[model samples]
Target: MNLFQDIRALVIGALEIMQADGVIPVGLDFANVTVEPPRDPAHGDMATNAAMVLAKPAKMKPRDIAEALAGHLAADYRVDTAEVAGPGFLNLRLSPALWQGLVKSVLSSGEGFGRSTLGAGQRVNVEFVSANPTGPLHVGHTRGAVFGDALASLLDHAGYDVTREYYINDGGAQVDVLARSVYLRYLEAHGQEVAFEDGTYPGEYLIEVGEALRRKVGDAYVGKPEDVWLEPIRDFATDAMMGLIRADLKSLGVEMDVFFSEKSLYGTGLIEQALDALDAKGLLYEGVLEPPKGKMPDDWEPREQTLFKSTEHGDDVDRPVKKSDGGWTYFAPDIAYHYDKVSRGFDALIDVFGADHGGYVKRMKAAVSALSDGRVPLDVKLCQLVKLWKNGEPFKMSKRAGNFVTLRDVVELVGADVTRFVMLTRKNDAPLDFDFDKVLEQSRDNPVFYVQYAHARVCSVQRKAQEAGIVVDDAMLAAADLTKLDHEAEIAVAKKIAEWPRLVEIAARTHEPHRVAFYLFELASDLHGLWNKGHDDPSLRFLQEDDVDTSQAKIALARAVAVVISAGLGILGVTPADEMR
Candidate 1:
């Protein structure tokens, strides 16, 4: 079904024949050999740099090897012609029937056509949106949530066992700030005027939490001192904030397989165990770090602290695990959490962090490397900020979230599907502009709408075909004579369909789910092109009156396009629209 992969196999087979016939040296490495679509369609259907890659190693002219390889490749039934291009690059034109067969394959396979086994059943843990348990998720966390969820789905589709995880930062001082903020709201509920100081959360959403606390305990904590109320309220407030966060994530169609609490690492011996694992490997030691290069803190006196030898595993410098006061640093628990993941037998670990956390990437990777003894690989993806715009102006701050745009605000403005798809329209590390006006616009420039429109158009065709008394079942269309689909526009659509399998493999390999959005745009464009061509040529239309056989063949192609669109959108966690409303 993968035409590119099939041809690469053929190329390798031909090269091996060249070796057996003594035309090329035996045991030449074919690992670098690749067969992919040429940059320009004029070059050929596919191109390979096998000759150029092997020239210096084999001590032979590239053209001599390319010419010899071309002769062997041209003899294959699938390869119509193989010609030497610039600098001994081999350009190949596949037989027209091969492309024709690809369309039929898509029809037969349905949505499963593009599924790949490239991951080989490896277990991968993807931790994302570990936003502090201080408030409901904001606009920035929304992008990371969508990106990480889509990445998990993409890897799952490509044969990886993916676990979506969320790390709760309840052990930090910020959650303490949340507790104090809720305490102010509690006081206000007791008919006492309260003011939010500089560090306390000032959002009105906590008013409900205050009202609920008043309903539960009346005036018990109203006249109590800080000691009597602080611990109990901290636990209650943390749980409430987690409830709100879970609801927000649910609204965006996200669910986590695990919710690891940083507090759990403190009470248990987990943090100590994780650091001990590193220490046994000679990675932990007492050390003094130099002051910051540009601007040192006011209290910048150097002090000996417990540190991890992160430099051995590629970090810029060793990082502190314990402060000079013998308290665990913020990074110590994170290292322990990753060690726990490594001990769980995952083959790989992935962290989707915000771009602001870019400085932590190297140290985190080093921790995982040392903890896992280089057996497990960790990939860190940084999600950039999202700037919101509305009515052609910057969208102001949210009252509910105090100083930021809440995730609920976004989901309310545009439904969950639009929110998810628009967030992934850019690479994870690139800034995203989520313009409320532009995203909901029905024009082709809006990627979510454009891709949805393609699926809706296919549904319209199916409805029209069925109303005209034509059999539109998948089995009937799949068995139709596909050779009747010979138009250039039809072939171009089929070519795009062929790219789906290859696209999934590439996106999954790179762990970049944004590429799926890009591929959907291209697929939608190809489908729209075919739809427009029908207006100019009646024969290109999916419904053909008085010609049931040809109509079924064309409908098969249209349905296959919808099938791929639905699958791609499914990975994005965006519901494909059957009709634009």
Candidate 2:
């Protein structure tokens, strides 16, 4: 069903024939040979750099090889003509029937048309949104959540066994601050006045957790010291904050398959086991690190510390595993977590981190490389900041979240579909401006609305055709005489539809789900363009008042567009709109 792939196979077969016939040298690497759409549509339907890439390797002139290859390719039934252009590139003009058949293939495949086997069923664990369990998720976390969820879905569609996971930063000093803050609220709930200190969380969301704590304990530790209540309260507060975070993610339709606690890595001998694996490979040592670049700190001193030879695995320098005081550093647990992932037998690991975590990328990759002995590859995607705007000014912060806008605030303002779609409208590492007013506006500038409207318009066409007593189901349209779809404008849409399967593989290979959003917008534009063309040319309309055969053929093309859009939106974790409201 992948026309481009099918054609590429034909090109490869023809090149092999050239080799057998002694027209070109044998054993020229064809791995770099590619067949894709030409840069300018006027050039041809498809272009291949086979001759150019093979020229130097095959020890032959590119033009001579291209001319010989073109003769072989033109004999195929699918190729109408193969011409050499610009000194070596072979351009192909496929038969119009090929494009017509692509529309039928789309109708036959439905939403599964673009699904791929790029991952080949390999197991991949995607860990993201590992925010500290101390408060509701804010706007920054929302970007990471949406990007990670969409990437997981894209990989799933591209045939990867993906597991969505969240890492809980519960074993940290921040959670202790959360416990003290909840205790203040707990005291306030018992009709006692309390003031939130500078280091404590002052968000009103913790008020309910404090009230719930009173309900559970009945002031059992109201006057107790920190030693007796800190542990219990810290556990209780983390649970409450995680619950709030779960609700926030649910509002945006994100769900994780696993929630791993950082505390679980501690006291379980997991850190020791992970380091032992590294130590066995002679990666661990006791050394003093050089002073950090720039003006040295006042207390800077050379002290012996447990270090991992991260530089051997591509990190900028060796990293510390344990401090001089014998306490584990922040990175120790992260190393253990990735080791756990590798030990679970996953073929690969992907970590979705915020842009601020950019500095941690090389070291984390080095840790996984050393732990897995380079058996498993790690891909880290860093999502940049999202700026909120409204009324031509910066949006106000959420009172519920204390100092930043919560995910729920954005979801409630527009909707889950809009929030998810808008979040992915940009590259994950590029800063995004989420303007409340512009996103909601019904214009081409709004990609979510534009793509959704195209799907809705197709639905409207189906409804009108059904009212006209036309049988327009997928089976009927798929079996229609698609040769009647001969207009250049109509063929242009089918050509775009043919690129879906290729685009899916590209986006999945690059781990960039924003490419899907961008492709959907372009497809929508092509669909909208064809729809407008129908206004001036009565013969181009989907319904021909007196000819059912031609009408079904044109309607079949429109339905094909809907099928691809639905599949694209599905990969983005957004529902395809059946109608615009």
Candidate 3:
């Protein structure tokens, strides 16, 4: 149960009672009313803006409405006191029993305690880490991959039907570059010396691809011309690159439900079908007769080209779908792809792109808008760059990836859990500094270990309790006399546990998985604070001296914290450590 939601329901109920008693008008929009944890815990456990939002609409002063609402809320047993605070805001203090009971709910629900149905089973297609199939995934793609996977899991926890997708960039010129690169490697495999030109990939990762090609073809095309071997090598190289990419993604615990290929849209007429759907809606035309503003290209000239009327939706300019030479621009294929997504009957589309693609957001949204007739919504999230630091110095390029740090390199250094957690420690659109040393540190300053340490400590306590002949199983703990859990510090930890359900909804609604990481940090802090308090006060210890009943009650609270931590870490694709070693 969400205590914040419960309190909001109480506030709404109180307002309804006030209306029934004729203390206020009968009709006022309560949609804006919300109960959230006060910014400062010093204020109260929860705060509501019901009075402030309804004052102007009800033709009553905020204080006047707050006083009436507070008086009515104070009658509920769950709310200890509802005090009207500054500008008609109501601060609520819940009864200790309510927070104590939350611990029981958490233990009874186990890993499913914080799961929410806020999404209501809506179909959401999340396309992410669609890196070009030119090479193995690098560190930048690692960040996007982790973020997208966690987001899909977060939405799934919130009850959305999520489909994780990866769009292979095999239809671009980059794959041809890969083909030429591999062909050179193939020459070397046949005892021919070759120099990699500026356009060809020279990474050591492709050496194995070359060796494998030599094994499969037995040097049959070693001396063939470009026209004879280019097409076959291009297909072979792309498949090899995809294999490497899949391995890199698997190393970081990411799995995609769909691997859509840009090449497939070429032969299947899907691109034409998508554009025809938009053209039928009068959103497509053959006209792009204006030069870009401010800085025109040296080759700039007004040419009639196929354009989409994206300006009518929400774009800076009408975007070109076909170039003057009758070839589809990059934006055209992208528009057709999204148009196909809309026609596939998805309720929503979310694209996780790098920050460099920020300029494409508005036009892409406009295309989806015009194609779906404003019925389907698209959310584009831009992930910023990840800067790696080691030994307090910026890390240079990797030897394996040749130019940049490969995803495998990062995962190898810190393992998958630390790599995943550190990637999500910052907001998606903000720059992230990933320090190798800090993430591996064992202290409380390292949030990943700190959260895992809390879970491990609980496991240690359970072992100790079992050795002492105490019953700490779920059934026993759920039936424990929880009234013994009355210490101030113990109740405080339970209060943090009560925030899980509410935190899930907030993180899922905002499409921000980092919030789960932040909440896990705070929850760990609460647990550690309470654990430290036990060193000073023996009564607060989770394991009592020969008092089985009281010990089970306290142990139940500790297990409840572990439940939430495990669930949150599961969403992040981090395995919760049962022991630090």
Candidate 4:
């Protein structure tokens, strides 16, 4: 039902016929040939580079080949006219009947109309929002959570087997800091005074964790040394912080399929096994890394360490896996984690990290490349910072999260639907400004409102048609006389609908769910444009007064727009509005 794909197939068939008639060479590769929507709608419904791409390869002039191909395409009933533009680019204007029939197809298919099979069922692991398990998630994590969840859903829509994952950073010095902070709160519950040092967390959120620990142990560790209670308290505090993080993600409608722990790779042979696999490939060796460029650190030293040959796989330099003191560096666990993912037999891997982690991308990709022998591809997406504004000033920090605004704070003020949609209004790598007053404004400048209003308008039309005793359900509207929708404005909306499947494939291929948000806005503009035109000409209205047959035809087109909008919003994890208020 993809009109662009259907027309491309028609063009390819014509080229093959020309080759058979000896009009062109027989062995030209047609893979480079493409049929896409013209940049300007006035050019034609679709444009193809078949003539231009084949001209040099076929040893013939582009115009000569375009003239012969146009003749063959003109014979098809679906093609209205095939015209050659600059440099022998072929533009095809499809018949209005083709666009009219697309309305029926959209109604019959419902939301499933634009689903694609681009990934061919490949298993893809999407790891995102893997914030350290030390506190509640902040606004930075919110962007990553929304981006990752939407990406997983988009891959699922495009036929990829997607697994949403979170990696817990529990095996680190930060958890030790959390443990001592909880101990301070525990002492406070036992009628003792304690001061939080610079290294300990001082957030009010951990006060409950302290109270819960006092209730569980009955002050057993109140006067104990650090060695006696540090280990057990570290485990307890990590579990509590993870519980808080789970609740925060649930509030924003994000759920993970797996929660991996960095500690699991320790006390086990997993890290050794991963490094050994690389060593077996002749990629690991004992060497001293070159000093970093520019000013040297006060503690900088050149010492022999166990390093990986990351540069061979495309990194800027070989990276250290083990420090000079025989302890694993931070990069070791990351390499081991990706190795475990490769061992799980996933076809591909994606990591959604904060923008600060941009430097780690190449080395991590190299690790996966060497681990899987280039079989599994890894793509890392970094989400930039989000600036919050309210009442013409910067938003205040959250006391609950200590120094940052918690994810729950944003969701409480705007609700989950608005929070999710607004987070995706910008590209992941671009800084986003989330303005409370502007996002809530009911106008075209607000993308979430504009898209939702289109869906709500269609619902209003259906209710009016039902009250007039005319059936407007999907099954009935799909059977309407769609040829009655021959007006140019109405046809334009149908043209926008025709781009849905193609847009889905492109967005999924690029691993950019923001494209879906962009396409939804454009489609809404077309739907609203046609709605405004109906006021000037009563015959163009969706619900024609006292005409049942014509009303069904027009209503069918509007419902098709809603179907696409609901599907797009569903991919973004936002609930479509049936009424704006």
lDDT of prediction 2: 0.95
Q: How accurate is candidate 4 locally (lDDT)?
A: 0.95
Candidate 1, position 174, lDDT:
90
lDDT of 3 by residue, 1-581 (tens): 78888888888888888889988899888999999889998888889999999999899999999999988888889989999998899998888889888888888889999899999999999999999988878888989999999999999999999999999988889988999999988888988999999778988888898988999998788788889988999999999999999999999999999998888878677778878887898988988567777988999888899888889999988888888898888887898788778878989999999989999999999999988899889999999999999999998888766788899989999999999999999999999999999999999989999999999999999999999999899878988999888887888788888889999999998999999999999999998888899899989888999899999999999999999999999999999999998
Prediction 4 TM-score vs. true: 0.99
The TM-score values for the models, in the order shown, are 0.98, 0.99, 0.98, 0.99
Write the residue-wise lDDT of candidate 4 on 1-581 in tens digits: 79888999999999999999999999999999999999998999999999999999899999999989999998899999999999899888999999999999999999999998889999999999999988899999999999999999999999999999999999889999999999999999888989989778888899999999999999799789999999999999999999999999999999999999999999799999999999999999999999989999899989999999999999999999999998999999999999999999999999999999999999999999999999999999999999999999999999977889989999999888889899999999999999988889899999989999999999999998999999999999999999999999999999999999999999999999999899999999999999999889898999998889899999999999999999999999999999989
Each candidate's lDDT (Cα)? 0.91, 0.95, 0.91, 0.95
Q: Show the lowest summed lDDT stretch of 10 residues, model 3.
A: 284-293
Residue range 1-581, candidate 1, lDDT tens digits: 78888988988898898889988999899999998889998888889999999898889999999999999999888888999998799999877777777767887787788898989999999999999988889999999999999999999999899999999998988978888899899999988999899799999889999888888888899878888988888898999999999999999999999999889888799999998899899988888998889987898899999999999999999999999998989899999999999999999999999999999999999999999989999999999999999998999999988999999999999999999999999999999999999999999999999999999999999999999999888888878888898887887788888888899999999989999999999999999998898899999989998999999989988888999999999999999998998
Comparing 2 with 3 on lDDT, the higher-scoring candidate is: 2
lDDT by residue (tens digit), candidate 2, 471-530: 999999999999999999999999999999999999999999999999999999999999
**Which residue pairs come into collision in candidate 2?**
none
